[model samples]
Target chain A: MTEADHETVRSGLETHLPRLWRYGLSLSRNPSVAEELVQATCLRALERQSQFRTGTNLRAWLFTILSSIWKNQLRAEKVRTGGGFADPETELVFDGAASMETNNLLRRVLSEVSELPEAQRQAVILVYVEEFTYREAAHILEVPIGTIMSRLSAARGKLAGLDSSATNARKTRADEVGKN
Target chain B: MVSAGMADHPRDEDLVAYLDGELALADRQALDQALSDSADLRARLEVLRGGDRPFRESFDLLLDAAPLERMRAALPDPTISASVISTTQTPPIPANDWRSLGIAAMLLLAIGIGFAVGFGTRSDMGDTALLAELDALEAELEEAEAAADAAPVATVKGWRQAVADYQVLFTTDSLTPDQGGDGALALASSQVGLNLDPATRAAAGLEFRRAQVLAFNSKPLVQLAYLGDDGVPVAFCIIASNKPEAGTQYEQRNGLGIVHWIIGGYGLMVIGDLPEERLNSIARDLRKSIQL
Candidate 1:
């Protein structure tokens, strides 16, 4: 693309960075990874600016780039190491929770959702949390609406099955030990 | 947690869609009525609702996830706001930035055009120097090429001896034909349509010491030489030949670098201890001053 076109697409992409970051966080579940993912998405969007129709949804276009990059990273990671999340403690490094109790609760929730399979977790985050319509989430994820619906349904089922009290008790005991 | 009582209850997808308001109006109305009648359906719906909170809370980090400024820095300056209320109205890049882009585009276009013209095809023979000069020049180049293979670059015979002798004459300020200062030197150079101007010498980090009109193979050659700021000798020779040429060829000897190229029907060669790039720059300057 010409530099002018690049600058234009860049400004267009700047408008979508926050949502892209959130979508990145949802996909990677790690702050640093999400940051890098958003950076890559912006770069890719700028590089391929010509592909973007000027008046189309820039947010959707950026999300599409982010989703594609994150998926490729996941695929490369999978090829390199057969796919896995980092240790949960590493993820905790960026928790920035308001209090110990909230931290525990947030971590519990995070762990539960993170443990869900990728498709289900993404479906839940994009639809329920991000509040995208099923169709919009489908477009972002590049899946059919039926796939989005079922994934969301399955995610809810898994999340509902987690015992919050048991998770809290576990965190409480771990905290007590740390204190000792 | 819906007790195994209600059949034909909305499937989980349908219920999730209902919660999402993704259900069609008629389907949503039917589920709303059925929900009021069946406690089990309400409980089932409640369980689905419970999952929504954690999912929302899990991603809520995003709500507070301030954009990392470094993310925006990847773009050009004057940051574009992430809240660009509408993408269609993307701010135009400033005009000067556009002008810079235009200049860069033109530069690349010029380079491409130059490459195509320089190497793409032979300029017609008529566009070259007369045939006899072409033959003589090619023969001289061929002989120099064969001699260069057997000798170190600085010690190449024929022209090397002439350049070395000229270097000595130039270093000792003993040039004949033109032995005066700036005015006389400029007069001599202008007479031959070339300049032995000190500004050019200064640009090449040398001080002009003398200019001479000499001959090689009965062809008039203008020899201009200088002493570098460090006292090493540098020299340039402009030859008036009827030789056609392709482009410049570079030869480096011991420490001296030589560049030879033809302008119109005259050949110009610069011999120096400077880098080949420096020699080429001087050659380009001289080429710029000459017209076919």
Candidate 2:
């Protein structure tokens, strides 16, 4: 690559690497796997640099690549393991001490989010965490906006239920503390 | 007047748009009014807005404790250099090893041919040639291994320099805009190291709508832009001191890319259509460069 091109790639890579890792982590729920995914994604991007449209959204393109790689890996693993899925409840167990005091409510909510079905989880993360627009998320997920809406709805309903339970539990605990 | 159940609590779809402020003015007004009147709805909105905070904070703490230098050492040396391509291209490998391997393979093939040719006349000659070919193959394998062990450090050095430059830029108050309007200009300057094409650079300038410098890790953190190549930026980057252990993360909403990373002693983000590779490369480079 020309010095300029190298600089461009380097700059772009530096700017986006963290987010890529995070996205990978969120999807794989493992740091090592996320790193591998990011590395593979970068190598692929480097190999197929010519395919990148100069003025296009580089992050989205990379994400598409990462998601495809991750999904493929998941599919391959599924084939190997006879299609068993992970338990959402187990994944939602958060360590209370690991969080800050101010974030107690937030942690409770996310744990509940983690319990959502895979589609709903993706929808919530994409909508809430990534903050993508409904149309844009639909494009990324290759589903209709309505599907995005419904998935989001399901996620929200589940999260709301979780939040209500958490709040109730907290209130009960507070009352007990007051009586003591 | 609508009854309690029918008072328009904002459907899930509308809530998403409302959170992103993508709703039309009329819708926004309605949603805002609803939020004012309904504590439960307001609380729910707050929960959604604050959903990722713990994750971000946890990731940030992890970054603080991570051994960044070790991570840098673990990274492969960049074989591709900047001074040579129209687009991204892999760096060419040294030819000496290939030449030796090729020569050995050819010698082995020739010896096999000789054995076949002499088999009727001299069996001893055939065995001798075969043995010599085997020795040559062994020698070739050793040479290949030795060559493989010696990686090009220049690429790693380049990556280091890029990271260092990013750290310096991120830490020094050189680019922080004094006012909000100047943030777009500041972002444009940050693009200098990125080496984007002029058109892409210009487009980035247009896409950057605002900038803010906030304190992170006792140093300034710059947050800028809402427009992205994806049509809107749902992402941002944070260039801060000391790399985050867990690294950066992204989520896309409404075609927006939200990116957050720590470079030097500051946090940075660039939310846009810019690809993840581009963002990652930049973040990694910055992380490697930041001093303390």
Candidate 3:
């Protein structure tokens, strides 16, 4: 590639690769799968170089590509296999719960967030985890701002319910310890 | 009115907009007011906003784990050589130009010596006086070159010497803005056309943005060019004078003219793009008003 072309590609990769990987991991929930997804996205980006416009936001473009790749290629297989699904009881069980109660509470909250529906999970990850604006997330996901808002709202509600339950559980454990 | 005051809690959409500072001012005001009244909504927003901390931290750790070499390996090689080659080519110098000049001068000198010797054989003339004069002139040129070279390389002392040599071509008055028609200003301006040091040009108050020093003549003279802040092409012919008194001489190819002087432990120069009259005015002012 020409120097200008090389700089364009290098900068695009640097800025968007991490976001692509994170999105991939969210979709696949497995490190190896995420790595494969990111690698595929990069190779596709290189192959389709002519489609990328100079000076536009490369991160947005890459995320859009990755999202499409997941929905079109990975989604059906993932749904069929349901292989990476977390077992709630096992995932929620914390070995250090008695000694590190606060950490246990936080871990339970994060696990509950992970258990949210895929749409809500993606919205939460985009807006809160990756710190994208709602408009940016909506654009990346090919949805309207209203859709993002509803998803985030649903995600927040689910998290609040989980938070309350964890708090109640902690209170009961505290009560038992006091009684002892 | 009671029902309006008891309107349902602002939706999660509004809370997200509020967090991002994107809500309309009035909406933001309404949400802030509602947040004060509704502990449940506040708690919900706080939890949603804070819940992503571990996720972000973990993602950042994963990104850090990807080796820098892996990222570098992913990038295509830059075709820098092709770009460089297409951008420019050095013009070829005429092979015999300097050689011809040297041969011509040597032949002329030999003819003159032969005539002097043949004439001395025929008549008792003051040939010795003529020969002595030529020898004395050669010695003076050598002295000038030696004096210019004595300054250390890449030091302020070296720059100072270059400035002094350049000043010798002009009259001795300290250059300033008010002295518009001074011979020193004219000579300094003319000498800047000669190749000189780039650093001395820069330090002497000629603004050369993104300049590279192309050539250094002996120790005190250099040539440089760069685009100026004004987007004009600026070329410098500079000289550094390292005498106890130091100064710089500068001339421009396109934009500005400069001549700096250093004498009696102080340094000074004239710099601008104006006509000779205006430059002289500036030079005279610089000479009379400025200490260095």
Which candidate gets the maximum DockQ versus the true structure?
1
Show model 1 residue runs off by greater than 4 Å. Answer: A1-8, A78-85, A88-108, A162-180, B1-9, B54-58, B62-67, B77-292
User: Rank by DockQ, descending?
Assistant: 1, 2, 3
Q: How does chain A of every candidate compare to the true chain A by TM-score?
A: 0.69, 0.71, 0.71
Q: Write the per-residue lDDT of candidate 1 for residues A4-67, one digit (tens) a residue.
A: 6555676776766766777766665555456556665664564356678766667777877888
Window of ten residues with lowest summed lDDT in model 2 chain A: A78-87
Would candidate 2 be rated incorrect, acceptable, medium or high by CAPRI criteria? incorrect
Of the pair 1 and 3, which is ahead by lDDT?
Answer: 1
Ranking by TM-score: 1, 2, 3
Model 3 lDDT tens row, A1-180: 344554585567766666676577666554334544565566446545446777776777777778876776555654554433333233221222222434544555546655777898788778777778788889989998878876775566565554545544543554565456
**Candidate 1 lDDT, B7-74, residue by residue in tens:** 34466666778877897776777778879888977987888777665556755654565355645633
Chain A TM-score, structure 2: 0.71
lDDT of each residue in B1-292, candidate 2, tens digit only? 1112212645444565565565667767777888889897787676655433344443333233222332232222344221111122234434222332233223223211222111122235544655465456557645755675775332332221222222221211112112124233344334323212222223322333334332222222234333333333322334334445444776443343445654434445544445676655544544443333
* Fnat of every candidate, listed in order: 0.33, 0.06, 0.11
Task: Return model 2's CA RMSD, one decimal.
Answer: 24.1
- Backbone clashes in model 2: 73
- Model 1 chain A: weakest 10-residue lDDT segment is A78-87
TM-score, candidate 2, chain B alone = 0.23
**Interface RMSD after interface superposition, model 2:** 17.6
Alpha-carbon shift of residue B251 in model 2 (angstroms): 53
